[model samples]
Target: MSTTTDTAPITIHIPTPLRAYTDEQATATVEAATVGAALRALVDHYPELDANLYTDDGTLRSFVNIYRGDEDIRHLDGPDTALEAGDELSIVPSIAGG
Candidate 1:
């Protein structure tokens, strides 16, 4: 038997702090079924980025903010947020502290 996962090619906007890991590219395109998958694909290609975006246990770091268009993934379904073809994602690092 064979199985397939329908994935879409989505573009993730790279923030300045993480651009070096992405070869200085402003954006990256990855095929994924959800936001989690898309982020995994990114780290797969840029291994160094994984440590910065996720914690030791594989959970996304608290300071890394991800948005699907105008909506925050945290307000949606977190990493399980669904994606469609050509979805635009932005990564905003929480760089400020109280």
Candidate 2:
């Protein structure tokens, strides 16, 4: 991929529960080459969100699921999933209910 493509802006949808960490913004725009990079940028921009999204081992928390459009990243390339310009990644948290 070209430098321009790697630097393309990717929008990540922040779920309602995590909104408080992002100043209440529903979405965050970042320039990254992969889903992981975009996520890191978001956490870097909002340091407080790290503990909520990642485990102490530096891996994504199991309860958090990220999707690109209708497909989950795990079904794609996981966090290494390549991102293109205008790509939108949504963070979906798992909810357990009886």
Candidate 3:
């Protein structure tokens, strides 16, 4: 048996606070078949953020949220959702005690 998969290349906008973990780059481009895959690519590219972005259970952190353009993934399908080319994503870490 053989299987084939199609993946898209999308760009993720890294917020200011997370730039330090990404070598000061404001954005990064990754190729994957789904939102979850894209995030893993980001983690691979910036290993410093492994703990901050994901938990040991392979789930996104509670304080971290992902956006597909202006739409929140939590309301969509979490990370298992698929993304397309030219899609924009933002990693916004929830702030507290403001």
lDDT string, candidate 1, 29-96, tens digits: 99998999999999999999999999999998989999999999999998989888899999888778
Give the best candidate by TM-score: 2
TM-score of each: 0.91, 0.92, 0.88
Distance from true location, Cα of 78 in model 3, Å: 1.1
lDDT of 2 by residue, 3-59 (tens): 625566999999898899999999999999989899999999999999999999999
Best by lDDT: 2
If the candidates were sorted by their TM-score against the true structure, best first, what order would they fall in? 2, 1, 3
Ranked by TM-score, the better of candidates 1 and 2 is 2
What is the descending lDDT order?
Answer: 2, 1, 3
Report the C-alpha lDDT of model 3 over 20-95, residue by residue, as the tens digit.
9998999999988778889999999999888888789977888898999998999988887778878889998888
TM-score, candidate 3, is 0.88
Clashes of each: 0, 0, 0
TM-score of 1: 0.91
